[model samples]
Target: MRSHHLLPLLLLCILFLAQCTKEEDTSPAENLMQEASKISYTYPALSTEPMQKASTLTAAEWNDLANWQLWTPQLKLGAGRLVQEKWHFALQHRYTVVLTDSLHKRITDARITLETSQGTLLDESRTDNNGVSYLFLTAPTKPEDLRLKIVYADQVFYIGDLNPQNGRIEKQLNIQRNVSPVMDILFVANTSLATADKLVYLQKELKEIINKTKSQSDSTLHIRLGSIFYGLHAGNSVIRTHPFILQPEPTLLTFTKPYTTVTHSPETIDLALEEAIYRQAWAKNASSRLLFLLLDTPFLQDPGTITRLSSLSREAARQGIRIIPVSMGSMNLSGELLLRSLAIRTNGTYIFVTHPEEGLSNPLSTISTYTDEPLNNLMLRLLVKYSKLN
Candidate 1:
């Protein structure tokens, strides 16, 4: 009888111990997946169409095509230069015009050309609904008398100070760009532990953007640099005193005290937009207005918060403020989804600074992917997205 009782007790203890071991083995990753799952929502209402291109648009326009108001009619903006044998450019519009009849039909098959002052044609292209594409080129020889001409059937139009619109064209044409151009950008970053090293890498990259744009000869991302570090680790979080104009911090910023914090939430982001951002007059009008977010939190976590985030995103889009998010550390489903949602809603881009352990890309790309050099890809995308490069 004693042996039987003792055997049952022993087996029960063994079973409990096995259960504990299983839970211990799965806790960390399981928790991550659970959080990610909570945010794995499919928002069918969100627009996935390409944004209305202005006179200038990058090859990579963040996939939002509805709701927001993009600057009039450009796809890509900025400038290009011929350095050595290669011609590099961000592709800003020098002049733009929409061809339409009284019936409001877009002239899709029209021919557009740019010519030298001496009537020599330089570049000729066709038009889509958005308008004709005209890019500025920094040739080795800075020749004067560069002019533009448009021909639709028998109608002829010249773009210059003295030239007027062709009788066939419907609207008055001018060289119009975006309301807020990304040439001058404001960066907001999370100062969490996982983002510490990543922040350093980004700061270096930011310097590259600043240097490239600052050249009087070269144009794009050329603005006075500024950053606002947000999170628990940030010491007394200082908002910029003079709008988005802070001297670029040279040293790599590190907040190495690991405390797995959630700094990127809807409230925090909304506050940043209200105080740190929208206070500027340019918030309403610039050629390319862009906001770069470096963080682990893509957006809000809870449903209530996410709803608020949607409103904020729409407002940002209305103001032409594109919110580009770059996430660091372990990629979770929730963060990725929310981030992509924010970008799409605001007509922006989402950059994933993912580390590969299993080393594979999620089919949706909202989840993490294993990359050899994530930064290089990020930089290229940034150039294409923020610089509006073709």
Candidate 2:
């Protein structure tokens, strides 16, 4: 009788122990995934059909079919000849026009081109009177440093900050040739054949432009940005989404992309993580400024991933690091709840991304407002808060 009772008790204890061990083992990885999800997200609802129509243009009359507001400046922390080995960029604009006559039928063949210091390239298109226009580019390795320019019709649009020193095209070429660490761009093509054609065309144009600018040196990255999950080809636009995120610490921004695809490998993750940590370390020791983490929400759902990120957050907190999670989720309530929980747990801020276009522009507003405040007042407030934390 005694043996029988002990056997049952021992089995029950073993079962409980096994369960606890499983949870403990997954906890770390789960946290990582959660944090990553909070850093990235997906919103299928934002998807709409691409526009395809002919342009109404006389041979002599030029039309500016692409929109330019969506472009953002991509800056780097490196000094000497720097190259963005492989970066992705996304350029979005809406193209629409009023009908000059009743029942107007005009082919608005709209296309987007990327102009770098090295050269000019064309990309995917949606031709319509008024609709969203998106373009992607992968820079060539030849030009060490360059400025990316957007061209539509006869006029060239300047998206980045640099101005053309010589002739616009010549100045751009010079920059691309002179830069040291070369840059190569990876492109994620969209699902449509039209989109792929657009990207291919852009690459071809870029090759010609590069050849005209200067000479090739190093090979850049296979891709700069990619979907966290799948079904999307890596593209320049995706990589360019968070240009500031790649900067060195004291000013580094973090991002989690939704939709993982084959192009996104362990190597890329490791590189990005290392860069971020290095920046954080620099800021902590040098400027004494707190590091801010910018996380996208929808991407942080899988429990396994969350566990891993949670452990990292704990570690960061232990070292007096501050993480700010910017929730950019366009999912339903369930997804929102999961993201919010992670943000709250990490002691970070969460902002739901209802519209990609809106969310992308909102950051600028926030930054601008903060910049206008008096520095002394801001410093005093921060110092007071730090004292309280101590």
Candidate 3:
């Protein structure tokens, strides 16, 4: 009897240990998914007008930028006739995209009916005037429950998925704003800053150009101004800090406010001012100039860097740095989480290159390589062209 009781107890202990070990082995990614599941994206109240007004780049601009590789849209063409598939909502918004080619002929007429998993939701159509017809959907919906059928051009083309969260298909035109080819780029060379070399490169190349001639748009072409402070506590020093010199000689485009002295503090006022300049770089009818930042990550601002990202996101909208977080560590799930956190917080993109040697050399490289080299080039071009339109 004693032996039998002991065996049961031993088994129970073993099971308990096994469960504990499994939980221990589970990674942060698992934990994050759990957290993400608990939360749902609620659309902000900002009107569609602002959203439309905010983007000045037209289809042509986007396409031109695409040519330059500034930004690219993510495209997904189905394997064949997309019979059926399941999809989840992103940002609590669900959408469908349909595309059809008339074999080789121009598709003149087509009607589409949308059905949800539950039942029919919408019936719509457009007759091709020239060669094609397209539609824009602004409302959000629930998942795979949606379907489309071709009534006119029955065997025209396969059904393609158009999930807005995954891709943007809007026709983008370029805004024609002349980005100054030359400027006085401030090289704030803090050991804490990551892209010091790139700043130095811009300073060297652009400064010369700004000195030689004005921008084609006839606006003064200066990218940055003031000093490049390098050293510990250099961020705190008043000598090169803002307010000390806010006048016109060295125009204040962007400034890296001192890193948070306390946990979770917002970026300094000076930094905020600089971001304003960055956002207007492609503003319609405005001189194209920018001020960017290259901050080293895991700073004192917030723990896990997650808590502090909200303020960063707003700043990103106004400022041009496109908040990129470079981890000194490997690009693992945790590192990616950090990057994602920054992206969420600042409306910026993330790049995970582990070694310092492999990091971007300067601020321009981030735009030139990451932002401009991508498909958004189309957006940029559209904006540039749009400026001319104005």
Candidate 4:
């Protein structure tokens, strides 16, 4: 009942509060999943409301960033049950994710199967809204490969050899979702000397995709190919060259060296696009022409440039030219948002190249052939869609 007794009691309460705060700061689950894992969430904006969002953030940031909410799910006793269960099993494994569409939104009801590096099935699970599913194996384990198969509707995604002996536990899986056939495609490259390496790589890759598609289809598919090459201020301050149609072939034939480079100067994508409006050979062939732009920088950002770009986008949309812009280079999300806007506005695909051979919607590049199966599947899907619309 004295002042001394009250002081000791107050000190004890302060210490208790500090302990609680420290616990909240770092739990085992948080520690496991909080390793700053970067994930890309690409959804067409709910509206045209001008706002900025992070394209790269921690795994913790992803939960809150999904819908622009500032809240994350509170940690619970079962927060990382999958993590805990793995320790008990000899053949331990945990969360696997399923992403659908080019937007990479999580597929809620996808079926996931865990298997050994060999041909044995370990267990099965399904994804929630977060596209995460967990698995447990009661059998004894060996130091072999680990793999997963995710099936949704007609889509089948396979990610195998996920855990080698030296692999990390907290893993993020990326699988390409190749849709049905597509229309005749035109792949454009900006070959300004600065981005010349990227352009060279793109041309070689695009040619391979064309060749692969031809080999798969016994010359049954009818495909038309258009190729466009623009350089520093290409088509601007001079004449224009939007779509250069390749020769007719049994299968859709893509062009290699469809164009010859005149000069290497600063890239003027605005001028390149303006010429695209008049690229009738490609646009007239199909109602909605499919053009893929691989570039090292965003379009020029001046008033005249912006005006030309806006006009080009509108015209392209009207003439059935959907611009699929692939943003390369090391530009951050803020800078790359310009490319995103072009995709959204034209109702096309916006893909930011997170790595040399990943996070690609089209998933076709020179360095990797991971797209062979899926790309073939998508080509067929597009044919059906394009035929129906035409």
Say which candidate scores most in TM-score.
Answer: 1
Off by over 4 Å in 2: 1-275, 278-280, 284-297, 329-342, 353-390
Question: Which tens-of-lDDT digit does each residue in 31-50 have in candidate 3?
Answer: 33222232221211221112
* Backbone Cα, N, C clashes tallied per candidate: 24, 72, 59, 12
Q: Write the per-residue lDDT of candidate 4 for residues 1-390, one digit (tens) a residue.
A: 001011334335544554566554554333322221222232222221211222221000011112211111111222222212321211122233434544555444355676777757766644432343444444445544667776656566667656543222233335443322234566666654445544444433444445544544434444556656665333444332434444444233323331324433435676667655564465233223466766655444555655566557645544445577765544333224345445533435544444343232221111111111122223333333333311
Candidate 4, residue 123: Cα displacement in angstroms equals 50
Candidate 1: tens digits of C-alpha lDDT, residues 324-389: 776654445445545655665444665554343211123223122122233533344344334432
Least lDDT summed over 10 consecutive residues: which range in candidate 1? 76-85
TM-score of each: 0.46, 0.24, 0.34, 0.41
Q: Scored by CA lDDT, what does every candidate get?
A: 0.42, 0.25, 0.29, 0.42
lDDT of 2 by residue, 196-276 (tens): 322333333333323322222123211111111112336321222223222123212122233334322221121232233
Off by over 4 Å in 1: 1-182, 213-222, 233-242, 246-268, 281-284, 297-300, 356-377, 388-390
Q: Give the higher-TM-score candidate: 1 or 2.
A: 1
The RMSD (Cα, Å) of candidate 3 is 18.3
Error of 1 at 138 (Å): 45
- lDDT for 295 (candidate 1): 71
TM-score ranking, high to low: 1, 4, 3, 2
